[model samples]
Target: MKDTQIKKLIEAEKKRQKKAINLIASENYVSRDVLEALGSELTNKYAEGYAGKRYYGGNDIIDKIEELCIDRALKLFRLDPNEWHVNVQPLSGSPANLAVFTALVPRGGVKQEDGTTSVAGKIMGMSLDQGGHLTHGQKVSATGKFWQQIPYGLDPVTETINYDQLREIAMKEKPTIVVSGYTAYPRIIDWKKMREVSDASEGLMMVDMSHIAGLVAGGVYPSPFDYADVVTTTTHKTLRGPRAALIFVKKDARELYKKIDKAVFPGLQGGPHANQIAAVAVALKEASTPAFRKYANQVVKNAKVLAEELEKRGWRLISGGTDSHLILVDTWNDGKKREPLVKDAAGKAEAGAGAITGKEASERLEKQGIIVNKNAIPFDKRPPADPSGIRLGTAAETTRGRKEKDFKLIAKKMDEILRK
Candidate 1:
């Protein structure tokens, strides 16, 4: 109430959110309870270590609070504490993933004859332009600098992951790990196959389900717990919590559990943000309710409707359609129905040299009070800054109480903007 400067900016952001049709797949709106917890007095605490083990004093209440969050996370996901060690201290997804890889693969490298060195170990993962996150091994990220990255892409024709090729590459590359979950690809990943590939290559498997944490909790999408050696996810996306993340280590690998805990505490972060953790607990509790399950299912329903409506409008959908809450559309040109085996002749004349480019479509849509992000479709010729596609998700809209009909209308709005 005192500092109107910050308060006014906050109010302005609130207004913008209220007025916009948010279709960003990686975003969602949290409830009032979650927001309250995020701004509670718990933020004043200085709990550095896990529950019951604090580096500073005055943590009696903090211990119980963190334990409650850990307990709720396990219960919400139906995980047995004996089999999985849950660490709720990660600041976010990217850091959490870095801790995992840093624990498994240290930063030391092999010295060459030239006195130079190369990062040891190889991480097999999806490529960024093909819908993979930067942490998965894009050169720009530290993950790539720390270790070698073996990038895997989708089939040019199908625009979907080919398990056979993945297995072959894993077997030959023999990477240190295999990452299963993705950022933008709108299809269900085969966790079992990924596990098999990891096993054959004598490597570990990790799944970043940050984008669909709520769906996994609601039992709508496939759970990676049964297959992955470790699972990392953010609480803020479909989970509808504050900005926080969780790391789940399989109990079968007790050593890995210990390694991950150490990496998170000493290797990466210092004292955890108790307020965010408290909000995560509240969100986890809310996600376990029956109402959340309905919301999760509806998210998928709305996405399917979006894809269907867009297809009816002659928009080309990458990989045909979506099985989750996200859809990727190639707006470079009239995707309609023709098989695009190459990247040329895609984005139209308006694009000049590039497709509508994700940036153009995004800006045009934003002008109409609709929000979305430009993305790269499979075999996209344009660069990452402006890819050949635009990504749409129904999580935020579905959370706003919009249903299938509303999503269909949203799809039409998208079509109209792209046309302009």
Candidate 2:
């Protein structure tokens, strides 16, 4: 490493990771083998097309690497190669999702003065404020720009999904596709109910299982494959892989695989990152082992212990509890006397009692070597940047060999910090 500055920063990050109690739900630590693959010589090559159908000449080895990745991905998830097709070339989760929409959804077009047609589609997904990802067609994202989002939310009192309301919305909107998986959602999704909704609306079902892919692989969480027509997931997150994504399309009369493949290659990106693909292959193999299964189960257990401890400590948990590795806690005023901003005699806004915001809670936790993200809870009145809640996860800490006892202690520490 001749670049001394970059090397120093990398070393500093390593030290930081070693000391910090990582709770970021979207993050995880990869193995040394995955790291080696990421920095391998395969990065020097440019394979602009799929395996064996490449535009470049020196891609025979690249083809084999990619084929192995696709094979392991299928095998890890117990999917038959003949029944399911996977595209491992999309740079990350966002582009992978975009490729799916471009391939399957119908884009209604408007004629322009320059004799061109501008097109947009419709996507039905959970509302961002209620635990949806931005790629699920939130207004600020490009997914929203090129497509209109028909949003759904959780039940106000229970703070969990209401299948009846979701079906009604889907039936009314008749969106081109309905997305099931989410970012901040903590419970196991009812894929069968989602399937019914998609069926009633005559729309495609795509589940972005990016957050829970590893749990699904370990058989700890329900697999959405039985219901969803297509599934998109990032290899990172709970998958414990590289920062890559895979799009799996069910083979049927629709021929969705071909459309999505074209969208990923010529329709979206050029040469695939052969190195990242190889790393993902290693991860898929690793995830198939019995040891990884234990790790996945422990992840959920650790999250439960953490959530229960937090609740007992007087913190309000969204949905009351969790069935997955994620938990949302109302760290602010808990929707009670939330008037954190009030006018003084001079008509100037001032901070009031019990006014700790999510942002402040996150900062306080970070100061104590715990890392978490501020998030918006269901029916939250506070803004997204500094919402009324904080999201915590146990995957990374559990990966570091933390258990129920460790999480209990971590929860107690967290309660102490935030209460201050």
Candidate 1 TM-score, true structure as reference: 0.93
The candidate maximizing TM-score is 2
Compose the digit string of candidate 2's lDDT tens values, residues 178-220: 9989999899899999999898789999999999999999889
Model 1 per-residue lDDT tens digits across residues 1-420: 799999999999999999999999999999999999999999988898888778999999888889999999989989999888899999998999898998887465668779988558888888998888899877889999888889999998898889889889998999988987888989998889889889978999999999888999988999999898999998888888889899999987347988999999988999999999989999999999999999999999999999998876667789889999999988875333333232345543222122366788899999999999998888878888978789988999999999988987888777767765
TM-score of each: 0.93, 0.94
Evaluate model 2: give its TM-score.
0.94
CA shift of 35, model 2, Å: 0.2
Error of 1 at 399 (Å): 0.7
lDDT for position 304 in model 1: 98
* Global lDDT of each candidate: 0.87, 0.90
The residue pairs found clashing in candidate 2 are none
Segments of candidate 1 deviating more than 4 angstroms: 110-119, 334-355
Worst 10 residues of 2 by lDDT: 334-343
Worst 10 residues of 1 by lDDT: 346-355
